[model samples]
Target: MSLLDHLSEHHLLVKYTTKNEMEEETRDEGNIRKEDQCNTVKGLKKNWQKWANNHSEYQKHNPFSNNRTVTVQFQKGEEGYGRPREGSRTQQRGHSAHAHLEKEVDELCMIIKSIGEAGGDGQTRVAFGPLFERYVPISNKLVGVLLRARKHGRISFEGEMLWQRRDDDVIITLLE
Candidate 1:
């Protein structure tokens, strides 16, 4: 049934003791809906922090002159936005950055297998030249992804480091 119908049926039936109380209940329900509808939107400020121990300039950086998306913050005592209401599905589906990173690693593997040459040993291998040319267009963080893939034993290379021009001939083989 529709929302209004469900609320009218259930909301009224659940506590139908007297006619006067029913009128009060209806008014309270309307007020609750009005409060829910009148929401406030605010732009988020960028928060920046530097790693004091890290020496790399990359680690010591902050947000640049980019206009990021506005975010929502649910304040405490405001019912904490009363969200994901106890055992709700949204509450159960937690977020994980590693899960997405792992998916990127898997995509990297797919790109290698698709573009790379196949060996008689039934392994797919691609040179750094081809892989870089192909993968860089998909994601600029190709080196980081490659390193992650290697760490997961998904792909193997010969060197400790794979630089752009220097390691162009480095063969990245997908391990079974």
Candidate 2:
């Protein structure tokens, strides 16, 4: 017997039932002509042949020559795949720099608040030169902290023009 006949006889071949047949099965039984059933089977056979041919062509082009399979090497007590235990020096430095910047931002906020309170206007003008000297030694780092503070609504600029300029002498008013 052919492979199709053998599979069909053993009920191993998956039967493709049409939507109408499924709907009719849910309602009442209806008689279907033998020719129509034969046509459906022929269509399913054609679809299967097309799919098989495409798959064969794909395999021919992308043949799996290597028998080796990659296996993950995990440390003792490791559960699943994740980030490596030891990170690069740059990553460590970045984390340290971020932490340092956060500390500087906190100090800067306190200084700005104190300066604003002393002025009795709830606003204080801060120049970059003094800010760099007082809170953060690095000018760029101080700028980052100030930008972050402004973004979080902790501070506001005096004017629109102040944002575009970041000169050492440029003065910015911090508002509570």
Taken over the whole model, the C-alpha lDDT of each candidate is 0.76, 0.62
Models, CA RMSD each = 16.5, 17.8
Q: What are the per-residue Cα lDDT tens digits for candidate 2 across 1-176?
A: 99978986565224535766656654543466668868997999999999999766544433262424443456666773343224546468878977986776677778765544334575677665565566554344666677877776766654433332356566656655
Question: Which ten contiguous residues of candidate 1 have the minimum total lDDT?
Answer: 40-49
Task: Report the C-alpha displacement of residue 39, candidate 1, in angstroms.
Answer: 22
Q: What would the TM-scores of all predictions be?
A: 0.49, 0.33
Which residue ranges in model 1 land beyond 4 Å of their true spot? 1-95
Q: Residue 160 CA error for candidate 2 (Å)? A: 9.0
